[model samples]
Target: MMQLFRHLRLGMKIGGGFTLILLLTAGVAVIGVRGLTSIGTTVTLTTETNRMAHEALSARAQEKDALLRGEAQTITQTQQHITAIGQQATTTKEKIADPTINEQLGAVVAAAGDYAKVFQQATEVRQQQTAAEEKMAQAAETLVKMAQAIRESQYQLLAEIQEKTQVAIQANRANVDDVSQIIQGIMQLRLTEEQFRLQRDAQTQAQVDSRHAAVVQLARNLQARLQTARNSVGTQVNDGMEDDAGLDIHTLAEQIIDLLETHHAGFTLYATELTEQLQAETEMAKQARLLEEQAERIRADQQQEFAALQQLQHTRPEVRNATLANVQATEQFIRGVLTVRLQEQRFVQGADAQA
Candidate 1:
């Protein structure tokens, strides 16, 4: 081969050398171009990764904002942002050549999906809590109105009882002793009724029942005495007393009986109303307890979700912070519900108007 090259013509040898050099230069240029192309691709991938990271952080910020604002529109916006990030991550992962990077992107997509799902669940629970709170507030308002009505009824009944007692005493002046006894019994009944109104317990109810029975008996005795007096007046009339005096006594006795009967009927109705009010209060207490329990359940669920999020591996700091903010917001909401329940209890069981 060396002898052949040595014996070749000068021009041919130079042309061959030049051709070789050109081929070598072309190979080198191709290699350099490939390297530059690879570097550009790497730079592009890096820029995309940085953009995805920025998007993730922005989505996390939106999540926190949604939690702080507690608005449905904000929450929906946050969810959409997270979904977009997840989609971008998926697209980027397909382009990634490194298996490890691809896996990391997959983890990010999973985390975003989890966050969106959990956030949606939390939003649903928050809505339920709001509905429950509204219901509790409505019940409380109704209970307050019922209490006002009961108080008004008590006052009206008491006034009626006092008026009837005074009328009975004035009408039966001759039977003052009987009237006094009847008045005493009525006063005792009123005292027991007031006690029942204040306490609304079985013991106080029993006292009221006993007092009612005693007043009924006293009223019957007074009626019998009035009947006797009426008969005596009739006998006196038959024996020559003034007819006008006898008629007046009879009319007064009838008036006293009518008043007693009317007052007794009113008291019976008042007792029935008291029983109904008591039942209403009991139902209100039960509803309040149920609302409190629901609030507790919501709080527990939020805590459990927070714990689950904490346990997740490779979670971004932004996602973790957003989770914590959501938990805190849920806790605040639960505390408000508990406060409302406390107020309901006070309204249901407390005797004072301040309650």
Candidate 2:
């Protein structure tokens, strides 16, 4: 091959040399173009990755702010931002060469979606809590009204009892002492009932029951005396004995007996009313306690959710601290509300104030 090349014309050799040079130059150009294209692609990928990272970081900041502030508008803004970040991540994952990076992007998208759902749930829970608190306040107000009505009724019944006792005393002059004793027994019963309502202890309740029995016995004795007087008066009338004012002693005795029976009936009605009022108060207290327990359970659930959120890998230290503080504050506020409700319930039920 060297002998054949040496025998070639000089012009042909020069043309061959030029052709070889041109081929070498074309090859170098192709390699340089390929290198430039690769560098441009790498730069674009890096820029997109950086932008996505920055967007993700911004979304995280917004999420933390939204959670700390607990505002609907802020949460909505955070959700929008997260959605945008997720879309960007989805697009970036398609471009990413590494499978691990794509997986990380997918994780970020899922985490952002979870955060949004969690925020929505938290908002709903807060709304439910607010409604429950309002209902509790309304229940407390209703209890107060019921207590006031019961107290007013008691006062009215007591007044009526006093008026009836005075009428009995005036009507039965011959049995005035017995009537007075009945009145005194009724007054003692009233006092015992008041003590029971105030103390609400077993001893006070026993005293009230004893006083009621004494009052009933006194009423029975007065009734027996009135019956004896009525029989005696009837016998006198049959014997033609009448009062100086031309009033029939038999009719007077009958009127007195009727008044005594009416007074006893009134007392029985008052006792029934008092029992019903006490039962109503007990039921109200039970309902209030149940509402308080429900509120406490909801608060506990909220605290547990906050703790779970804090434990997430994406949760920042600052956000965790803020969440903890918010939880403590909410607990303290709820405790104060519960204490007030408990006191109100105790007041309505006539339970021990100290307890």
Q: Which numbered prediction scores highest in TM-score against the true structure?
A: 1
My TM-score estimates for the predictions, one after another, are 0.41, 0.33
| C-alpha lDDT of residue 204 in model 2 | 68
lDDT per residue for candidate 2 within 249-271, as digits (tens), equals 33433443344344444434444
lDDT of 1 by residue, 1-355 (tens): 3356344433233222222222222222222222323444444444444444444434434543454346988887867766775687688667756655566566656655654655564455445544543443343344234323323433333344454556433434424444455456556655675565566567876776676566556546655665664566565333111132233323333444454445445545555555544543454345445545654665576577667767653755544444465456445544554554565455444545522
For each candidate in the order shown, give its overall lDDT on alpha carbons: 0.48, 0.46
Residue 46 local lDDT, model 2: 39
Q: lDDT: which candidate is best?
A: 1
Looking at candidate 2, the ten consecutive residues that score lowest on lDDT are 21-30
In candidate 1, how many Å is residue 328 off?
A: 2.0
| Per-residue lDDT value at 103 in model 2 | 57
